[model samples]
Target: MDNISRRGLLTGVGALLAAGSLGVSTASARSLALPASKRFKMSATTNEFFRHKPLWGPRVMQSFAFDTPNNRLFAGQLRSETPENSGDLTLSQLDFSGNVLGHMYLTGFGHAVSIGAEAVGSTSYIWTETDADTTNGRGRQITRFPWQNGKTLTSASVTKWKPVSGASVYTPAVDQRFGRLGVRHARSDGMYINVYSLAAARTGDFSTVLASFKQPALTAGIDFQGWALYGSYCYFWEGEAYPGEPDETKATSKLWCYDINAGVLVDSFLTLAGKSLTYREPEGMAVYGSTDGTARLYFGFASGEPGDRRANLFYRNTLV
Candidate 1:
């Protein structure tokens, strides 16, 4: 069980300082010019949220993001503990040291495949899948809501957005550097990623999009685990769990880099970053935009047995 704490009264000043460091005004309404995706190499690893069980289902963590403004991380897992044929979710809030400080429940929200966390001036918001489908319990729309500790929110309580008309199963990603938000969605035609201004996206005005591109079809070999949109590059995380007899050498994950601006598949690499963990299954992805120009691409994994499943977060930080 995690201990939840109330914030201090002096958050306003901290929030403003955080916003300045994040390169934003009260609202992130402007875009910043950054360099192109370097097709960077996976350098080192940081074990964030290692072997931590979530509040709901003790389930495998599916997605996560860094709440830079508040200096915390928000992680989510599917709520399949009950036989409701539901898409409810449980989100855990953690400090940098992997200590869970709080939690919130999301009803009728999809498998939490990917999540985006944004905050300004002490108020934090979560961006993820919502309006779940009854059949498979996947999300039909992307939604946003305030981060409330110890609170359970339903899909009806928040507004949902459909980036592409008639598109379903939407998972969102946020890059605060340029105030960008992107969603990977499936439509009748095919799967696509649409990027928009975070400000415009919040107000339900998706017009004047920044970038729209088709995601590369997954090859037969790679298992699709998670994805993230950082700057002009969209990254895909792929890896399967180990078989009954676990082999660390065989337990490997891959990161695929697709340059959205160039409209090309930049490069990809099969990684054994956390190969030592048992049942090492790759899960969610998020990008941490640092002011130093090193955009850290972070991802998560599920390890251990079913009843004792835990979340492990790793990142590829330095560019080659």
Candidate 2:
């Protein structure tokens, strides 16, 4: 398939290209039979992402989302290794096996903590954090823009939308099966997740929130990693990459579950899958609704050296 170029796209349809948001539609959200007992397990065998490498920027895969309609995976990463360029972000287009297909750049975007991917007809739009805070390289505004391969689009060049005001930081993720978009923010009191219909969020009208709940706390020193929202359940990361080589001494990454409806913590488990990876560090989490109508919760890990890193993705397609 030829990559469509929208480097000149300037609103919801033209500029940001609200792919799925152009029309009001709904798909009944389905649960993957995640344990309501808070005892989530990963008994399913794991599969790696075929050493998926980004076409540009730091090879670290910070966050990713599935372009279900296109059978593709979109990943987010920092564009540079220097501190002065930390605010820049990059998007890599890839196949489900984790092989690079194409790429684009989003300069002055946030830390690339999370990104939303939507495919409409022949166009694919990306939802991400923009308007870098400068101080810490975090995004203060959420924005959507069409994916223009080989093009560099700046925050000021695109339309910026802060779904919630007074939040110190903002990041976004998309759930294809549920047809929802979630923007997680950090406020004075605590972090919170605000979910909205994909149709409403794309148009900048968040007056009606589908779900609002406080984010679960993280381990003291664990870096806040990737996240995803499916139905009313929230899954987040709780582990960091090992410094050098990941070996027998390396720690297993932890994935936790939060029930947004009941507003409580539900499940937590350490995954030993991919324990053999080098420099094993947990990064992104995405719930992919396969073409066969089955839901798979994908968790990613970063490996290899700094300049030559590879993304190792694994998923649980069955209940544990």
Candidate 3:
């Protein structure tokens, strides 16, 4: 544990910190057991249009999606969170008031992390890439950019990443709801639910919607990070890698709920414990709406312990 004690335990848990606009509590927000201490008032006001000054520092932001008609918010930053940094895919674009409209650098690719975008038809916008380096064979590709001049609508193609039939293993996670482009792969052993067919304009075809299940028991860790698609169900999180046993118990975690249209697997939330405590790795997942809009399922755990500085936003509040 060197690197200055793992960056002083990721700067005492605030690893790459940023928060400033908190008021999270609308009473029973939507129920999934919402009482973890209800209090969400955070404000440092650093949304400087999605700030990015680190040329080489806190870069572990594996996945992020939200490009509602250019209102922007498309992140996939990685340089070190291992998985060989998955080819260091660094694509950025932020604007829903968080401005930073451009940022790109995609090399041959390795940890292209998981990303899935949609807007296919009235103009076109399809982005998909999931290869959290399950040693690399976990390569499931999908690329078609052109929301408005981003170009390569179907020239930067890639679609050979397969594994989705009766089931066996098709690891893919990082869903963004209704705008559509969901994924959570694994079968022949457990956990499965694939959705990606931007009207089938063609791009590594995927539309199994749901498969293999008998009860919440899907486990295949490391790269199936936070996934969400409330309402019909599809909330995911799984992690397992105790290899050398130090990097936070080699990373151990779990949280599942899939019914994305009745695919099955009601609930399972064994976050982390009794094996050497470790829950600091459950990347990006957000759901909060209810003024009558209804939406709950806030997740973003990433703690390295030591000094615990904040980054454990877990909330279920109803998805049953």
Candidate 4:
């Protein structure tokens, strides 16, 4: 292996060793074998935010259907400020090399909520959004836009915005179907998975799927956000707040994965192996394909022993 691959393998091994030292148990420690091309290279845009003012930071990202064919990546930027004051939500296009190519601003929406993209036709894509206001408790509707040319996109036409009944509005991730949208609400009890038909966007029709297992009782100050879908599974990392107690029994962190279709927990992996890594706050995850066709998941943690600002990425072989 070359220097880069060697470094990556060593990092993975180190992480496992650290976990072991901390008494973290789950998967056996093994060096990650990464394809040379699949090794992650830090981008110039690696910082928390782009060139924009206030630097709200880039939170979540999803791809447009035409991205692979056209060599483009469409992602939404979640602004750190509130929507009423900031009125910021940005949609950007990036090249395969992680260079920003094109971008547009979204107005009226409080914060650019969650983003989902689907192929409506041969070369057409439908992008959807959901706001992040909890007080309203009403989920916004879906908006459709066509991504065309290298740096041009058609105007967004609002198609659906409806209040979700009998459910508190929360940030949601969506998977599109031909006639409906499968939305999973990350809730305390577990993921509240719901399927909303496209035609019923204004009505917010939903079929709920509850977590197969009981929700763990977490200590106060431990923020438990729901899981994020990567491939066919959803991964969730639960961590404690800052100034966190070091007592592992009182405050601990873990990563769990559940099969999407089966709604069952396949496995739970502890982020801290043997206490080598003390997690402060963990948030957001993404998956990308390595050059050799292997897939890896990247997670971002807010704070830890390394530092609150330090962000670490981890990869595991795709089970699917």
Candidate 5:
């Protein structure tokens, strides 16, 4: 297939793209079928990235989303090692196997707490949680961008980005088929999952809260990091803080599953023990598969050492 640039895609579509917003139906709650722990075995780890770079690591790879239509994976890199107020956001474009293809550096967006991507025809839209600073009680500032493909995002593209009306949600996972945005919010009681209509929310209208429920097991202080919604299931990371460990990498990581439509806890298990990877501080997660029934899950690690050649370990496992 020839590469079709986003600009060419929009130009070719004309008024066909004008068809707007779809109505959202409420998801019914039901019992979730848990997956067996033995199903996920340790898989291969990819090459290391951002090794010991002061400007990057400590918390380099934070969040990622799969652009299935484009056959690309987009990852959010938080520049936590940099000075405060100096900018701490970057987006990396990658292949299915986790190879960096391009990078977009976003300045003044604060820390990228979460990210969701949507591809319209060929144009790509990125919705992200930049920071936690509240304006009018919106817990975090959520921004959306229509990226024009380039080696790097132009200043014009950055300027054209707009804000989405959501507050306090840290994780944004896009279900393009249903046009819904599955997000995770922290509450005093527990971790809550809410699905909003993407079509309605884009127009600054949020009448559709597709699904809303709390998962008490995601207890307070158990950091809910990476998240991805696939089919009827929502997969997320629980990088709960470890005892006597200041570095997040030392903390163990686990994967939790929820049936979004059924509104029930399906499965929870620790990450597979990879040969070269320890699955520590797993942050960003993404699901990629082909139509022929082949599927794999990808995960990004937060910390490790360049000396051990395991500084930036990212893993992929067959879904079977």
Candidate 6:
């Protein structure tokens, strides 16, 4: 974090304090700039199997994470259009430019809600919610995969347990620099963020909660779509999509970039309104940047309508 962003964060905190309480409002502080014209697009077809389907399933690229050291993008896909049929999960590997390199089909899981990817040298770790259903049974767990030659997926023994039930768990973000895992989800009141030590979480030791805060920006019943943590900032995303019907005019883009280190929001803005038509429901996020303060943010949107079920990835080059 630079002096400029640090000051911005402090100023935002002071404003919230003076205002008495944090409410559902935009950060009246700095605003993020429009994404650069240099953009890339990939369709559900990139995974090959999903290309010919008339209506792409509900969870097409539901979660996203960037492996900084390996320069690979990991995307988690739920093949079922509805929760009742939620069982099949696929993990796709791609490059920064939206090219699918290879993919692996993940099985032996029940209702995978979200996925977080982290890479340390040749070993890769993925955190996700498993055995969770629309009715009951949900738990957070991590898996280890070592890829030096052939592709293989193995499960790790989760020795600890701290269960959060019945809430829609969005994507989790791993902070490699700090060895922390950040997770967010929706409840009856608002959204809650949980930051856990990566070292402890890997061993299923989720005892000490580093930072737990409520995001008043979301009201009760509002859906938490996607989020990511990079450097000292955390980017949150959601959209306004009319149920069943595809209306680009009614669809909206809700995005907020917060500085977790300073405990304040840095930027808030909305885009992609009546523009792409297919860019609705922002469900996944990934940030590729450094601590010195420069990043390219990527968002994955899943389509609901049949005609618009094509490519669904968007990017913004600037941080704020």
* Whole-model Cα lDDT of every candidate shown, in order: 0.69, 0.68, 0.39, 0.37, 0.49, 0.49
TM-score of 6: 0.65
What's the lDDT for candidate 5?
A: 0.49
Ranking by lDDT: 1, 2, 5, 6, 3, 4
Q: Which candidate leads the pack in lDDT? A: 1
Q: How accurate is candidate 1 locally (lDDT)?
A: 0.69
How much does candidate 4 score in TM-score?
0.50
Q: Per-residue lDDT tens digits of candidate 6, residues 1-320? A: 00011111111222222221222333332233211222211111112112211212334455667776666666666544333333345566665555566665544332333467678775666666543333322233334343322243322322223333544433356866456777665445444566777777777665766665554343122344567765456666655444444554554566666655445554555555324444345556666544424445666666545333433566666433
Clashing residue pairs, backbone N/CA/C < 3 A, model 1:
none
At residue 105, give the lDDT of candidate 2: 80
Question: What tens-digit string does per-residue lDDT give for candidate 3 at 152-266?
Answer: 2221343434435443223233333333344444443333345553344245445333222221334421344545553345555545333222354344465655443333444
TM of each candidate vs. truth: 0.83, 0.82, 0.27, 0.50, 0.64, 0.65
Best by TM-score: 1
Model 4: ten consecutive residues of lowest lDDT: 1-10
Misplaced by over 4 Å in model 6 are: 1-59, 80-85, 108-113, 134-171, 185-190, 219-222, 242-251, 261-266, 303-308
Q: Which stretches of candidate 5 lie over 4 Å from their true place?
A: 1-59, 84-87, 131-139, 148-169, 187-190, 219-222, 240-251, 290-295, 306-320
Ranking 2 against 3 by TM-score, winner: 2
Q: Candidate 1 deviates by what RMSD?
A: 11.4
1-320: candidate 5 lDDT, tens digit per residue: 00112111111122112211122212332233322222222233443333221222234566777666776667676444444334346577766444556667665454444578887778788877544332211124455677544434422344221222432434566766446676665444334556677876566555656556543243223454566656556666655322222443444566666555555455565543332333344556765554314345556554444222112334445443
Please provide, for model 4 over 141-234, each residue's C-alpha lDDT reduced to its tens digit, 9 standing for 90 to 100.
4355565433422223344443234333333343331233435333333324344444454244443332222222222233443334443445
For 57-127, candidate 2 gives per-residue lDDT tens digits of 55678888887777778888777554543568778888766677788887788777788887776688889
Per-residue lDDT of 222 in model 5 = 45
**What is the TM-score ranking, best to worst?**
1, 2, 6, 5, 4, 3
